[model samples]
Target chain A: MPFVNIRITNEGATTEQKQRLIKGVTDLLADVLGKNPKTTFVIIDEVDTDNWGIGGESVTEIRKK
Target chain B: MPFVNIRITNEGATTEQKQRLIKGVTDLLADVLGKNPKTTFVIIDEVDTDNWGIGGESVTEIRKK
Candidate 1:
């Protein structure tokens, strides 16, 4: 089973966009790795800007600066 | 920055349990790999039994037999 987890800053992605992500990721794995779509799992997590940090600063703070 | 995503079958996990998972995974990566905790990301996804499969059979179907 192949599990794919995608994390993005909570920037208001539409449901249709999320649906496309799930479908595209599943298809990509199946095409490249021969993984079964039924066995493949794709999860998307929208992280708060305050919760996600890069370079010792939260995304929220970084955006402010 | 270290990003960790944990996937488990949708068993009833307490909120406390999930909190511990987030903390433990962040700590593990920091202790083992010297990653910065401030920049570490831990996300957990619970999959439906019907969605997860192994050996060409879904977990839900396998449980029935």
Candidate 2:
């Protein structure tokens, strides 16, 4: 079984967009590694701007400056 | 900053259990890798039995047999 986890900044992705991501990732894994889509698990997590940081500064603070 | 994703079979984990997982992972990353807890992100994904498999058989099917 292949488990795929995707993390994105909380930018409010539409349901359709999330659906596309799930399907695309599953298809890619199946095509490349011959993994069964039925057994593939894809999960998406949206991180809050204040909670996600890069270069020691939160995304929320970076956006403010 | 560390981003940790945990995947487990969906067997109805309690809210407190998930909270402990998040806290424990964050602490471990900080202790082992010196990652900042403020910037650490821990997300848990519960996979459905029908979508998780091993050896070409789904967990759902395995459970049945």
Candidate 3:
């Protein structure tokens, strides 16, 4: 089974947005790819802004610098 | 852009297997769901058995225990 995990650093998203995103992702995978949603696990890990990085820089500290 | 990253704990696989796996995954996503492989990033991180865990136990140590 193919697992789709989305890890986001943004903490400002509302509950509805997260739910919609999950639903959209699941539907895209299941409906289009014909994947079994029951067996296909989707984990959304909401991480703090301080824990993520891009282009070899910390998102939090780099933004300040 | 949707990113499909596959992280595996097995380090014993050959390069061919890894290539095949990536191709299969990419084909499944692109052909079935019509995703653009150029924009849809697929990263396969091959992790050592020592770094992975399952059910709250490290894979390497748990196997010995």
DockQ of each: 0.10, 0.09, 0.08
What do the candidate models score in CA lDDT, each in turn? 0.78, 0.78, 0.58
Error of 3 at A55 (Å): 1.8
Name the regions of candidate 2 deviating beyond 4 angstroms. B1-65
lDDT of 2 by residue, B4-62 (tens): 87888898999999999999999998899898999999888887555444443445656
Higher-scoring candidate on TM-score, 1 or 3: 1
In model 1, what is the error at residue A1, expressed in angstroms?
Answer: 24
Give the clashing pairs for model 1: none
Off by over 4 Å in 3: B1-65
lDDT of 1 by residue, A1-65 (tens): 89998889888999999999999999999999999999999999887564454544456656887
DockQ of 1: 0.10
Worst 10 residues of 3 chain B by lDDT: B27-36
lDDT of 1 by residue, B1-65 (tens): 78766778887876556666666777777789998887787656678999999999999999899
TM-score of each candidate? 0.54, 0.54, 0.48
Q: What would the C-alpha RMSD of candidate 1 be, to one decimal place? A: 8.4
True contacts kept of each: 0.10, 0.04, 0.02
The 10-residue segment of model 1 chain B with minimum total lDDT is B14-23
lDDT, ranked from best to worst: 2, 1, 3
The candidate 2 chain A region of ten consecutive residues with least summed lDDT is A14-23
State the TM-score of candidate 2 restricted to chain B: 0.91
